[model samples]
Target: MRIRYLLLDVDGVMTDGTLYFDENGREIKGFSIYDGHGIRLLQKARIGVGIISGRSSTVVAWRAKELGIEDVHQGSRDKEAAYEMIKAKHRLQDEAVAFIGDDLIDLTLLRRVGFSIAVASAVDAVKQEVDWVTKKKGGEGAVREVIDFILSAQASHTKTPFS
Candidate 1:
């Protein structure tokens, strides 16, 4: 099946599942440039991307904006509802969508999408249930690996051969 849209979780799937804070108690996150570029590739390929994280963060919003992704829905306690809304908004079927999740909160949508992914360091239960597992761990370019896979599968990649 062809996946035209992708939904992702933030904490464990995008980051290393670590929450950082300074003396001032400001939350900080580190993202992979490889992942950011891969997201751009997906957009260039005309594949829609969205975020459905349980936690809300300004960092995520800023990153999504930087990547030109418009379908972000953070702090979703009921991810299924968010999934349904996004699916309905795009008038897409289950077989055309993919989801990446790394925890129990992600199981429902993971089971619902046509393709499901788990990062390498994800919980064992999550890894076991996903359709694909990344060799790279989250916050370390795992999202990039998944994007490369999808782009290759869709024959949408246009990188030059480094011969």
Candidate 2:
């Protein structure tokens, strides 16, 4: 199936599932430049990107804003619900959506979406269930690997002006 939307899980998929706390009890996350540029390339190819994270973080909101991704759904414990809402809002079917996740919380959506991707560092169960397991670990160019696969599958990478 042709993919039109790419849904992501932030903690494990985007940030290596590591949580840091400052002295003031603020949350901190390290984002990958490779992932950011991959997202940009996906957007340039007209593929919509959305984030559905179980935890709420201002940093995530800020990152999404910086990436120009409007479909940000944070603190969504029930990611399937968020997935449904995203599908409805975008008027897309399951076959049109691809999901990348790293934990069991993402199982339902992963099994339901057309393309299911799991990071190399994902739980064993997650890796077993996914259509593809990224060679790169989360927050370490895993997202970029997935984007490259998607763009290549869609034959959009060759058409993109940027190298």
Q: How much lDDT does each candidate structure score?
A: 0.87, 0.91
lDDT of 1 by residue, 32-149 (tens): 8888898999988788999999999998999899889899999999998988999999988887888888999999998888888999988999999989899999888999899888
How far in Å is the alpha carbon of 146 misplaced in model 1?
Answer: 0.6
- Which 10 consecutive residues of model 1 have the lowest summed lDDT? 154-163
TM-score for all predictions?
0.93, 0.94
Residue 143 in model 2: lDDT: 91
Query: Model 2 — TM-score against the truth?
Result: 0.94
Best by TM-score: 2
Candidate 1 positional error at 105, Å: 0.3
